[model samples]
Target chain A: MMTLLFILFATSMWLGWHGKRKPAIFVFLVTIALCAFWFKHHATSELHIDL
Target chain B: MTPTFARKLNVIFLIMICIPLIGAYTIQFGRGEFPCPLCLLQRLAMLGIACGAMMNVRYGIRASHYGMCMISAVLGACISTRQILLHIVPEPGNTGYGSAVMGMHLYTWALLIFIATILILGVVFLFDSQFESKEATSKTRSVPALGAVAFWLAFGITVANVCTTFLECGFKQCPENPTSYLML
Candidate 1:
């Protein structure tokens, strides 16, 4: 899962470097969404530190 | 705040962002401690922040590009804040997730950096002169030598992270407290 995030970032950079700015931004957004999804679990996990 | 100088500053800014990532690597390899899932996510946000500055350097500087950075910093702060909170209440002998550096956990430091990114971007945004001349698009403009070098440096780190993360997490979810590279 973590690998996927960086892969998206690489794709975005490649796209941006090649002059595909719009798609690069889109790919970046996707990676951010994926990161957030993974983070949601960690955030909501029952931590011993309540709230 | 001409676009030319802004590009140079962005290059320097990109290099600055990579420093923490390198620091994380040193801690990972030097201290033999692996980053947890949350720690990995903070790196993602940092790289995302770098990506915005990278866009500014590669293409002509644009407000949208800076917007990209501010959004990333905001999300990163959320992740870092949550991680800090998770450990703040503390449990017996738990101490925290990873080893401390300079008396503060990495996540705490991450939150600080995210806030700094947002603040820096906010101030940079004030220099409206940098956003002039939208006609100077990526095709018309060539990045300066330093800009290209910094761009590659940040991109290289992201690519390197891709390889390291694959080895660490494999196709499976990362372990809560990673001790060794999973694929290795």
Candidate 2:
């Protein structure tokens, strides 16, 4: 998961560096999607552990 | 935007990312405190914000870049709030997972950073008065050498985090309550 995150960050970095506005925005949205997925995957288990 | 104001915003974004990263490493290496799964997620969110800031610094100030910061901050805040709620009313002698700093846990600090990020972005959006000229939009001011330094700093931190996270979790899920550094 961390690897995937890093890949996204690096891709975003590259896209933004080249002034590719639309692709950069796309990457950022993908990041948010990944965040949501990871949060849901972990949060449920954490809730079970804590409660 | 005026070049001066844009520069200031870039610096602010850099500092916003740097401080939390430095603290995170200090707590991890200095105190031998391993981050749990949620803590790792919060760190990722921080990196996400830094990436957005780096974009603004390296490319040019854009609303979309700040939007990246806002989205990541929201994710981070949610993660920290959940962790805080988990231990709000702990059992006897639980004493929480990681050590507290300045009378508050690290998660609390992360929560504060996330909130601050949101507020700062809000203000930036409200008073976007720096963007006052067509020239400012057409020929955006390039980042100075120092901005390159800031960009590298964020990149290095992100890489370090990736390494540490891989060590902690590899391809499998990280444990909720980690007891020690998992180096496999």
**Residue runs of model 1 more than 4 Å from their true location after superposition:** A47-51, B138-140
Looking at candidate 2, what TM-score does chain B attain? Answer: 0.89
lDDT of 1 by residue, A1-51 (tens): 889999998888888877889899999999988988988976657655534
lDDT of each: 0.87, 0.76
Best-performing candidate as measured by DockQ: 1
Writing each residue's lDDT as its tens digit, candidate 1 over B1-184 gives: 8878998898999999999999999999898889888899999999998888888888888888888888889988998888887788777987888888999999898999999999898899889888955667645258788888887888899999999999999999988878889899
lDDT of 1 at B107: 89
DockQ of each: 0.67, 0.44
lDDT string, candidate 2, B12-93, tens digits: 6886677888898899999988888788778878877887777667655677677788889999999999888877877888
Candidate 2: pairs in clash: B1-B130
Candidate 2 ranges with C-alpha deviation above 4 Å: A45-51, B1-3, B132-141
